[model samples]
Target: MKSSRQLSKIVNIFLHIIALVFTYFLLQGGSLIIESLPNRHTQTQLEDYLDKAQLDALDKSLDASNLEAETLSFNQQSVKTELKGLKDVLAIQQQNYKEMLASRYVTEDNQSNRQVEQIRQKIEQGRVAITEVTQKSNQLKQQLLQNQQTRNQIQQEIQDLKGEARKVLRQEQRSNTLKAFLIRLLFVLPLMAIAVFLFKRFRDSSYWPFVYGWGYFSLYAFFIELVPYFPSYGGYVRSIVGIVACFLVGRFLIHKLQDYLEKKREMEQRDEESRRSSLQNNERNLENSFEKIHKGICPSCDRKFVSPDNKYCVYCGLCIKRECQTCNTLQVSFNQFCFECGEPHREVQENEHSEEHAAEPNDGINSSPPTPSGV
Candidate 1:
């Protein structure tokens, strides 16, 4: 279980790392595509085309001048009067050609110059455009680079976040697992120890509750891991259910153990009480036997063991009572009172004199029965 848990944690870390790497590459690939867009080459091609156009215009201008020079160089003037009209016609034609050439050349030059100027302007505009494009591209590149750097930083931060989150999660999981383990150990180990103690002390089966509690707590551990998969309210429901389940199971086991212990204690109490009662009964029986051996007459109870030869209880006092032998009803031997009857010696003497006098009078007149002995 320990190894599997460790492996699972390692695997989770690996997966997070892979996810971060994948995200980084995706961002980089997008930046590269943006940087490689086709606008720069297109602008360069337009500049090249304008250069060719300017060159073609200059060539056409040179070709027109060569044709005009050839036409002028072929003119010959002679034959004075006859040649005059030919010369005038040739001159007119030549002038017309010169005018045509000049007009054409001027038109061509003007057009070429205008075209060259336009091309120059275009070139200038193109340069500015290229500079703007370059600036924009550079800015974009810089932005992309910065974005990449930021992405890298963010990726690092994300990695750190994931690491921290995973660490915290793992730590929490470990804590929970450790707590579960400790709870199980606390529940099971102590019960097992108790079972062993009971077996040693009372020699009975008492480990069943521990087994049941272990099974229940193990199930609780598994159920806790499932809490995140459920809906929001499901956690509360599961928590309540778990609490109730734990409570029921714990209560049941504890109640059973308590009941078992109570029964055992009751049995012990009953055994102790019965043993005490038996001892008391034996003592009572022994006392009865001794009474029987003495012919149902304990002199101590009958006040018949008062003798000068005994000092403590011989039958009960195991000694002689120091009293007058004539007074068999136990008399006081010390001071003025009888120890057995709580009567003063002077009162007993007075009663005896009164009895003697009453008995003498009774002799003269239907004497009252002799007063009961010891009155």
Candidate 2:
């Protein structure tokens, strides 16, 4: 019997495990279905919320300014190169004129003087060219500085615009997140409602495994899927949700406990015969009775026995044990046969009932002595 009980327990455990596995697959499938719902919020890009035309125009202006700056930079480089070449040419011309003046061919001939004048003229022309090139370089530097300042201002404006656009994007994203959360909630709420109805009405039905599986899925969907998306006012929302759930569950348990106590009290008020008859007619299965008996409790009233050998329940007066008439051996009263004599106890009980009926006097008001047939 103990081995049988153990086997039953093992089978019950496997049923629960199978139920959990079934719930796992159901949750997986449900998650896939929930995920299939279109999410427009997640597809949103930052650029989607920005003023595209304004940004594009700004970018174009910035690019054009950069191109112009590059051209100016190249021109500056050319100016520097030209100035260097002019300076080199001026130095060579001065050296050549100095050498010609110191040469023995410098006798004051008219041709020599003419050549000296021509050298002076060439030196003056080179100085004027150098001055003009220097002026051009200075102007280029000024223009480059202005261009740099303009680019800096434009970049700052672009950054400011982008910053504002980012703020708007974040706001929109948060709003969209709320909308999406509501949509998912709407989708899941009906499922949770159905699961709750099934749990309340049919959880103990024959298809309890499926009901439990659905209950687990609904709980997971609500707690895991929906709760995280709850708009948190510094966690107040989640706390409130938790408190409400706890209160509901606690209230249900309290009510169930009250109902059980009330029913027990009503049952205890019944007469012994009625109580015994009720027990025989509505008794739990042998397995439950054995468990209660093992725990030293009266199977009829569910009250603890004063001693293991007690013949009847002290509270309910339901028979627990009695001696067999055939073998004078004590055994459980509910058993149909005695262990020692293998005598059927029901026969003895029937004989005893017959004898009690025989001993009772007639009390009916309409009773009369019967006349002899000859009279």
Candidate 3:
């Protein structure tokens, strides 16, 4: 292919050479045409001048012969004098004709010389123009050759760039594959180990199947890297298989991790509940001890009790009320069932005792009053 291209280029160069040769011939032919054009015009003008000079000379000779005839016919002295004057006129006319002829020759020679000079100048100008054109053509050809060389260099550079790019791309692809493999090993391998450990702990042998499947997937990934020349569709198929395998393995690992965490959380929760229950029991025991130390008597029943001044009596339904001994004022009991006096229920006992003593001395004074019957 390269040789053929070189041959084609050689053929094109030969064709350009042929074209330049043809152009040189064309320019030469044009110079010839320019040179002949002025000569042809000068020749026409010279012929016309010669014909007019001949006709003028012939007319002058005829006029001189007529003057001589008039002289021969005259016999008088005056006529003879007139005939001499006519001969003088004929001589002047001949002299004037000779002067005109000389002037015409000089004028024609001057015009012919000018025309030749013009033709020569035109030829020189044509040569100059041809030289300038040839110079321009040479410059153009040089520029074209330089441009062709530049284009060839650029094409070579492009090809080199493409080759370098392909090399870099291949290197990058390999680097990426290696990096991916390392990353997968760093993450998936540890995860697989953890899965295996958990599987042993849980005694679930079924997890081994997924481990084997992941091993197969790793092998497949390795194989995919090995056969890099495969078509895009083939690579796509391998990628799909690898993805599905990785997904399945990942799902299994996640499920195992979830189960492990769930079990751990359940155990921790049970321990936490047990600790909470123990704390609650300890709090309840402390509360009981505090209650025993701060016991007060229930005043409603007038009984000797551990919880004196208790608002609700365990033995009786009556609310405790105490009366002042000095003013007989009724007050809610809080100070050992009586807020009015330091004496514990002394006023309420005394009032009830007097009434009860009047009724029956044997009954120890009724500290509480009985409900009145509606009569």
Local error of candidate 2 at 113, Å? 3.6
What is the C-alpha lDDT profile of model 1 across 2-69, one tens digit per residue?
A: 11356755865665465455445543553464334322112222223233454455455545544543
What does candidate 2's lDDT look like per residue over 1-375, in tens digits?
122366756976777887899899998999898787646435577788778888888889899899989999999999999999999999998998887787626565667777877888999999999999999999999999999998998899889888998899877776776776788799789889999899899886667788888889988988877776776656887799899989999999999999988877887776544454455452235556656777889876789999998877777776677677677787776566788988877534654665789777533311212111112
Question: If scored against the real structure, what TM-score would every candidate get?
Answer: 0.26, 0.60, 0.27
List pairs with backbone clashes in candidate 2.
none
lDDT per model, in order?
A: 0.43, 0.77, 0.45
Q: Judged by lDDT relative to the true structure, which candidate is superior, 2 or 3?
A: 2
Relative to the true structure, candidate 1 reaches a TM of: 0.26
- Model 1 CA RMSD to the hidden true structure, in angstroms: 35.1
User: What's model 2's lDDT at 156?
Assistant: 93
lDDT by residue for model 3 (194-276), tens: 54565456433333334344434334334432233222343785687679989999999999998876754553344322322
- Which residue pairs collide, candidate 3? 296-307, 296-308, 297-307, 297-308, 297-309
The true-versus-predicted C-alpha distance at residue 303 of model 1, in Å, is 79
User: In candidate 2, where is summed lDDT lowest over 10 consecutive residues?
Assistant: 365-374
Which is the better candidate, 2 or 3, if ranked by TM-score?
2
Clashes of each: 13, 0, 5
Error of 3 at 87 (Å): 60
